[model samples]
Target: MSMADLVRAGAPELPEGYFYRVRSTNIRSLKVEIREQRRFRSRLVADTWVFERPDESAEESIVKACDRAFKGWQEADAVRASYLAVTAYLGDHDPKGGR
Candidate 1:
């Protein structure tokens, strides 16, 4: 199975208006999506972490990664900042917008 599928299966339950947007080609990469919100300030939980574990299913690895992201975002200020940066970068990339 593709890593993307694993991520999709392993994704967490985000707060209302929040979601994780996975890259089409890069399965390991993803960013947070906050919908229809004028403002938000909490640190976004996302980072490039090696999720694979020995003897574990792809789904399990991804679930562990998501867990770490969630935990770090909740417990660390730096994680939140990193999350914002990722979201900002993603927000800047609008395929529908005329370039």
Candidate 2:
């Protein structure tokens, strides 16, 4: 199965206005089309998942984002270590093998 499919399968069911996309390698794009939600009383909110490398594409970006978010949430005090762990995981599991 593709990385996108895996991500979609694993992702939590978001609200009506929330949407996510995995582009190429390092550009996981998130689009929240909600009117307002509690403190975030805004019309729309767009967020980008960016990695340390500029050459990475959408899929890579999504993986990195997932890694960072998951690790960060799991270990708030060890954010740097978690980030490195995620990077290493991506490097080892990259389907293209850094091609």
Candidate 3:
């Protein structure tokens, strides 16, 4: 699937300023990046996943990558948890303009 389609499907729940995109792609894997912008600072992170085409579809690949990325963040303990929390907060809040 195209990156735009993936973003539309996967990021409806994401905060307004926070977004995700296909950072890189090759024959074997796609790298997805998620970013958040705050009033004073911004953060970005990426997740890369290699999927066998015969065994997985684009949607499945994206889901797997996102799941693994989020899990990794949760497992990293303090620092990542703080980042995740901030991102989650951004996601929960509405944009400067109304939704």
Predicted structure with the largest lDDT when compared to the true one = 3
Candidate with better TM-score, 1 vs 2: 1
The models' CA-based lDDT, in order, is: 0.53, 0.46, 0.59
List model 2 lDDT by residue over 11-91, tens digit each: 333345433443344344342121224455444333334454578765555555655444443365377677888786553
For every model shown, what is its TM-score relative to the native structure? Answer: 0.42, 0.30, 0.48
The residue-by-residue lDDT of candidate 3 on 6-48, one tens digit each, is 5465632345676555545656457755567778976875454
Q: Write the per-residue lDDT of candidate 1 for residues 1-99, one digit (tens) a residue.
A: 433454577755556644444332366544332222236544344543544567997566556666666666556667667888888655465678857
Task: For model 2, give the 10-residue run with minimal summed lDDT.
Answer: 29-38
Give the distance in Å from residue 33's predicted Cα in candidate 3 to where it truly belongs: 2.0
Task: Provide the RMSD of all predictions against the true structure, rounded to 1 decimal.
Answer: 14.7, 17.7, 12.9
The local lDDT score (0 to 100) that residue 48 gets in candidate 2 is: 34
Model 1: CA > 4 A from native: 1-12, 22-45, 77-99
Candidate 2, RMSD to the unseen true structure: 17.7
